[model samples]
Target chain A: MLERIRIVLIGTSHPGNIGGVARAMHNMGLADLALVAPRCEVITQDSISRASGADHLLHSTQVFATIEEAVADCTLAVGASARSRTLPWPMLTPRELADRLPSECQAPSARVALVFGREDSGLTNAELQRCHAHVHIPTNADFSSLNLAAAVQVLAYECRMAWLSQTDNQQPASDPGDTVRPVTVLEADDELASHAALERYFEHLERVLVAIEFHDPDKPRQLMARLRRLYLRARPEQMEMNILRGILSATEKAAQRKHHHE
Target chain B: MLERIRIVLIGTSHPGNIGGVARAMHNMGLADLALVAPRCEVITQDSISRASGADHLLHSTQVFATIEEAVADCTLAVGASARSRTLPWPMLTPRELADRLPSECQAPSARVALVFGREDSGLTNAELQRCHAHVHIPTNADFSSLNLAAAVQVLAYECRMAWLSQTDNQQPASDPGDTVRPVTVLEADDELASHAALERYFEHLERVLVAIEFHDPDKPRQLMARLRRLYLRARPEQMEMNILRGILSATEKAAQRKHHHE
Candidate 1:
């Protein structure tokens, strides 16, 4: 499960924070790392010093052009948010995310991405919309600004915790009094849709809305964002996603036929 | 409960790590910060930068000469250790320590101190003896060395999680399905004895042991450490400590009378 966990950082300014994030990820046994349009140089003397023994991770870290490119293959992309947004989306605490990871990773192709944003501004509205969910680390209200690496450390630690719990459950229940949490094993068809699939669905949905004259692309308000939130919150299964895309395709075909008839 | 949780660092090598610790503590709503003979300067540019907005905690940080002095007033002092010891004292995962904190803090006079040792060597046996128990953060076995600030951050995050859980339990159980956990509130007489008082009892016990010829202080192998581990594990209540003190005083008096007879 830990092997399938990917850490994605977007617009990180500090080289040292990148190093710290790598070290934090390695400390918790997470390996895959992706940087989306990093503002600062990825590896440097300061980063090496901060990384200590984990500079190998920095050397091997994959850089991407955008968040979409970074997490497109991931089944679940959860963005780390430090503030409340104008648009309320589904939110989970670090522990809650951890608790859900083991079950989410049951599918062999299911990869989970824990996305972190820039040091100062966090994920933009557009960037956050790409993720399936948001995880917030509980902090003192007066001082909630966690360093980028520190945020990764918290989430990575939770991922490791969730993995440990799953491993513990795999062991035979030694103590009768212990209440073992059942891990949800996904059937082949029940696997969640990947970020790329979801993104395609959103695009298709938007085109159909425009074709039906229900949404004005030029004057779009929060219609698209709200729809994205609803669908993302639902975390459509592979079969469910297929159903949704089929319905969308049918709508598009009908719209084209209606135009031809006119 | 968080107010009662003091973070004590013993011989910290880096000023920046201390600053990071202060920030982690403040972020978790823990206020008390104590440094026991730190190797580097406590306040510096590096520390301030790492601390960000939590430098106020650094300015108000308390410095002590010894681990005993730093945690003397604390009812429960838990040391943060990375490696397993040859002589195993009681060990807890960070989560377990956090889970136990709320009930431990129910006593009005009870103050819980979290002792972290040197950045390189961790808590020494003598220093570990001074704490009631040790907390080891679970890490990747292949690469278990957590950065000093990262270690503090993990524990502090757990502390915050525990505090949040307690706070949630306090709220009215509005959901019909909510299984509310009962919070254990301690009675006044059941208040645990302070570290200062425990140190005095240990001093008295040593004197009596030497007088009765049960212990040879000159050649004491692991006698004192074992005894310290035993008593610390017991965590004697105020009344229980008084009874033990009375017994020790009586033994001393009896030994003095025998010496006069000789």
Candidate 2:
């Protein structure tokens, strides 16, 4: 759905804004960019400067004579509108537009175009009418004037957010929440430290703690218990447990070496 | 709450980015802007144009000499990171940050800051350490060069949306479970370890690890990085941090005592 999403700028006055929009789109994983009769030159040094490193998007931008021609192949077209005008249109928030995209682009050929208008005067009534819905990026009422590129960033961001959520939802088995090692993000075969392994680690740790004089075997004083609680809460993976054991063994060796030297 | 949300740009080389960030913040009803050693002039012609009409934010922006100074008053500081770091820090999505804001700012004096680093290098290790958590804006992996203003726009937009949801709907807190991988469990804002405290803990840990010869300073095989990730994943409370620090001190004492005996 993200790749299917296209950013269309209509009558954009600033060529730099076009470059800005391209960078915004590329950042959010959207590739397709369409320009409909831009008032200013499409590709300029200013635009490239604003585009930063996303000049590939600027280079491959598709030019169209009209909005109709621009979104002709799109199954769904959502115009970025500041506010509703002469006719009331089915308005959606950027989030709502993102939510509707997956289903909207269910078919293989289905394409979605998110259209933006002139910097000063927004989409003309005809252009607004052509869109299936007008998606509004809720901005501060007092200063709702979002820069052309910024608007693209907001919508593209939401689109990417929704896509990420969808991607996460697909992997129920490997869901981070459900996973045993909640934090590590270890890519492969990261089993949790087994109860037996944990017990052995605790024994090794206790011996080292006593050798270091951190824990007194004569008066254990719930030290091991407290340590157990802390380590248990951490839910260390097998690899992490090995690291802990390595440290303990190193501590023991140091203590033994010093004792022998003495 | 949005006004309380400050956008801190660290070493922002481009003055126009400062203006662009100001405009983005203003669009999303955010006001506070802090600059930490900006490389270029704060207010240039390019900045004024990029900021559009939100120059008031630019004009009223606060300048800070350091990250600590910039975020001194903020109770919750979330740094915007691009990808997975070597030492895995607590990561949050924009939505996660917005969702947690209410609880985060329950205290009257609580201020939340969204920190953006230098345009090219992003946040340094030291800068990242100053943040309690890192918020990563999901971008296209291949071309993830999000312009500074656009990055601010995405985060600010999410903040606004979260505010809207909170205002419109009574219950926006829908059990913030394991949506993010690194955050094991985030308790109430008060008990969580402050960035300064976490920094101290890390310093103590490195010292002890070095003393034990578990970590080598010269050919560091990411030993400290791995340890940092493990501890950060645990999200130790203030009390736990104290306990851990005490253990480090004890270990250091034992190591020193053994060396003396030898």
Candidate 3:
């Protein structure tokens, strides 16, 4: 699904940025590049020179007169925005965007388009409205702007990761006797939120109890949240979950015994 | 065991080679690099510039006046030599040298040294004599001579691979109920006997085998040499010796059974 996605750059001003964007795409195994009314010439010798060894990507780039034409075939259009919008149309970080692509896109022909804005002023209201979703690359609050090429690199990297995850799910069976090593990739935000969501649910329960003054204000709310991060970092397997659940049951039983004695 | 094998360089000529040697050591997870009689100035701008980010190694480098003083306390010395010596000594390849170091010198006071020679002429006969063994790097016969830095890189790489194998062997021990992994240097040739003594033992074995007509002349001497190399590569343990003896007994039993049936 990530490979099927097209990255469309709108009105890019710098020839070097065009070249760099091409190089960045090539670095992350993303080859499809579309230019929408680019301010500078994309086929200049300077652009090709800056592209280094990614001349092939530059050569195969498709040019479009408008943003709509660039993403006409795209079913899911993601507008790259640096600023938060008043009416939030599901804002996603680079990590969230990565998860949304293959995991969420059920249709095979659901063409995913990552729309990059101009180097100077970002996408206008009309331009942003064309996109199905909004994606904001997390940067320093003071200087939130990122280089055009770097932005492409991050998005391309995320797309490649998401694509790899999908492909890995389709691997053939391994032999029972073969030496196996389990590799767990660290989660990038939204994947982390599933764990955080459980923590939030616990926090809500604690809040309700606290509001009713059922528990002391000085009492610590550290127990569940502490366990959450520890277990999340460990990224325990299914069998480990059973072991933890058994331990939890034993702890509950011990607490009941103390209550009965009291 | 790798920690016991101290890598000592004598009269190093190039700063880049020093840096490259440090990088090679880093790549192999070997941090010990001792410089004796360094021609190139220690920890200079040139050395630091070439070391890139591996300047920590250059920072920790210990300088000595002579190679003898540097390796005076060492129990086992393995010298890197390019040329064949008239006076024979135990010779080992980089992999063989890696297999040799780990477990034999269990005494905390015991030190094992791997001495690399000068850029122009390799270790002198006197220097080679001080070494308990000689290590010859296998290279292209047409162009066997490798750069000083490259030779260290190759040796360090082989050492690292062996070190990783040893580490992997220890990995099962991390799990309880599993028997402790033996730390014995079984795959390394025994350093107990000196070269001349081993040669005398080999001659005696050859004479005894010939007297018994154990080998046929038509088989060629190459087969025996190949078998010797294979056994040397295995660096068999005491338990493995028993296993081999058991197999020999089984073969003899089968031969006796065939004779009785005939």
- Each predicted complex: what DockQ? 0.09, 0.38, 0.01
Query: What is the lDDT, from 0 to 100, of the residue A233 in candidate 2?
Result: 64
Candidate 1: segments with Cα more than 4 A from true spot: A168-262, B168-188
Choose the strongest candidate by DockQ.
2
Ranking by TM-score: 1, 2, 3
lDDT of 2 by residue, B1-262 (tens): 6767889999999888888998999998899999999999988998998899999988899998998788876767889888645555667777777777766655566678899999999999767756767777777766776899999998998787766655433222331111222222345334655555666788888887888888888977766665655665565656677777777776787778677876
The local distance difference test score of model 1 is 0.79
Candidate 1: tens digits of C-alpha lDDT, residues A1-262: 9889999999999999998998999988899999999999998998888887899999999999989899989999999987648777787778888989998999999999999989999999988888888888888878988988888999998888788786544324453112222311111235678999999999988887776556688897666775665456445667667655754565555555555555
| Candidate 1 residue-wise lDDT at A86 | 78
* DockQ leaderboard ranking: 2, 1, 3
Per-residue lDDT over A1-262 for candidate 3, one digit per residue giving the tens place of the 0 to 100 score: 6467788999999887787677666655667899999999898886785465676878899999999899998888999988656665666766568777775556877788899999778888788888888887543333445556656766775675566467553324442111111221221111223454545444543443333233344765553343343345444334333333432333233333433444
Tens digits of per-residue lDDT, candidate 1, B79-190, equal 8777646666567777767667788887778799988888788889888878777777767766778888898899899887777776453323321111233544544346
Ten-residue segment with the worst summed lDDT in candidate 3 chain B?
A: B171-180
Candidate 3 lDDT (Cα, 0 to 1): 0.59
Docking class for candidate 2: acceptable
Question: Model 2, which residues run further than 4 Å from truth?
Answer: A1-4, A56-74, A85-87, A108-111, A124-127, A161-191, A199-229, A246-262, B1-6, B31-34, B59-82, B85-115, B123-136, B167-185, B188-190, B259-262
Residue A201 displacement in candidate 3 (angstroms): 49
TM-score of 1: 0.80
